[model samples]
Target: MKDIFSTIKIQVNEKIYVKDPETSALGRKIIQESILLMEEIGFDNFTFKKLGTKINSNESSIYRYFENKHKLLLYLSSWYWSWIEYKLFFATTNVDDSFEKLKKAITVVTEKIVDDKATAHINEAVLNKIIISEYTKTFHTKEVDEENKEGYFLIYKRVINRIVKLITEVNPEYPFAKSLASTIIEGSLHQHFLRDHLKTITNCDEHVSPTDFYINLIITVLKK
Candidate 1:
């Protein structure tokens, strides 16, 4: 799997960028450093000028790849989901049992992410942190509806629907497969956020992980 993924390119929507960052050295540096910078600072404080400073390039050069920071965030979000979709596909592809496949799919999405050495330019661990902290900004805008029409979120929705299929396979009578699948994806992020920043509210800690909580919740909800 590692060998295969090393050769695979995680493609994002072309509309999200002026130029594909994966195509050139400077562009790849922009992506590599942006994740570190975004994780260090934040989306609000993040700017092209700062990214340019970090990468030792002109701000105009950064703009050659991304029109603005929001578009860059969209690009990053798209790439993250696309990667997760790949992991989800491989994790559950050959599992024969319906309930077990659903559990594996849940584990893939909800588990704490580790860095994958296959992709040298992009760090999955830092990118996962960025996704937890900054992913909402990608879509929580006035332009979200228009962007949705443009298929800006197709990969994200596809991830949700993949799990939705697993949910229905486990329990065909369950009418809220879509709702449950979406919640598992979105709610896992929320839980991770809470686990890190707002520890008083979330049960997930060093011992009880978000994956454990979601797996138990799924079993309780679906075992009926």
Candidate 2:
């Protein structure tokens, strides 16, 4: 009977031993530092040893938390989306008017993309790789089923629905506002990334700020 009791206690302790807040915090720190390193060195040149050195931990420690560099990159990508969501949430919370809220959202998002130091350091190749990898992971699968489509579409629809609601509040007569909103959101992202090269190709010396372009584009679309 005593042996049985001792075994139960040992099992409980083993389960609880895996849960450590300090270790979790340390892991998060390692992830953030890894992102900065990727930004500096570019993803191709980034290595586990460099990341481990930055975090003052062994490669084994990082592997214990994350399987590999690819997994770490995915986590960083997810973190970027979460960061954008938080910024948009905060920007919209206090605005009384829907149009104002929408304007704030556009402005905040453009400013974040354009001005983020870490984001600027990540070259186009790395960004494209990350985007393509994530897209394929979420959409492409061995079995294409309704559940997969529905799951992916849910995320897209939610974003479009939110934008459409804001647009409709400002201009009720706009036809196919939902589709237009989706186009604007996606277009702005593409435009931001391509702006620097587009200017050079066009030989336009004057600089154009992403925020101004986004604001103007939004106003033009809303008016139409």
Candidate 3:
């Protein structure tokens, strides 16, 4: 899967960037270094000027690829979800059992991330941290509805809908498939954040994973 993923280009919404950052050495550098920089400094403190200094390019050059840091974060967020969507599809494909397939899909989304060595420029582990920590900033804005209209969040929504389909397959009578699918996705992130920071509140620690909790919850909720 890693080899196949290395060959696949994760596409983001074109409206998110002035230029695609995956196209050139410098462009890719902006993305590669930006991820490291954002993870190091957090999104609120991240800037094109800081990225340019880290990449040894002028601030203006960064703008050639991204209009501003907000758009860059959007590109990163879209790219991360697109990659996860690929993994979710591949992980659950051709499974014969509906319940087992649903479990696999849940595992794909909830498990701890590790760096995919296939994508040299992007670190999946660090990117997952960004998604867990900073992802809300991408959409928690006044421009979100307009951006949603522009299809900026399509891939992320597609991911949840895929699991929603699997939930309905497992239990045709389950009327809350959409809500449950979204909760599993969003709640997994929140659980991970709690485990890392506010450990007392969440039961997802080293021994008990978010996957374990969600899988158990799904079984109890969907069992006939």
Q: Which window of 10 residues has the lowest lDDT sum in candidate 1? A: 4-13
Ranking by lDDT: 3, 1, 2
lDDT of each: 0.93, 0.55, 0.94
Whole-model lDDT, model 1: 0.93
Give RMSD to native, each candidate.
0.7, 11.6, 0.7
- Candidate 1: list runs displaced more than 4 Å: none
Candidate 2 regions exceeding 4 Å error are 1-23, 113-161, 172-179, 196-198, 201-207
Model 3 segments more than 4 A misplaced: none
lDDT per residue, candidate 2, 69-166, as tens digits? 65465445444444455556667887998778888877655552433343322233434334423433433445336534434234344555667787
Candidate 2: give the clashing pairs: none
Top candidate on lDDT is: 3
lDDT (tens digit, per residue) of candidate 3 on 1-224: 87899789888999999988888999989989999999999999998888889999999999999888889888998999999999998999899999999999999999999999999999999999999999999899999999999999999999999999999999999989999999999999999999999999999999999999999999999989
Model 3 clash pairs? none
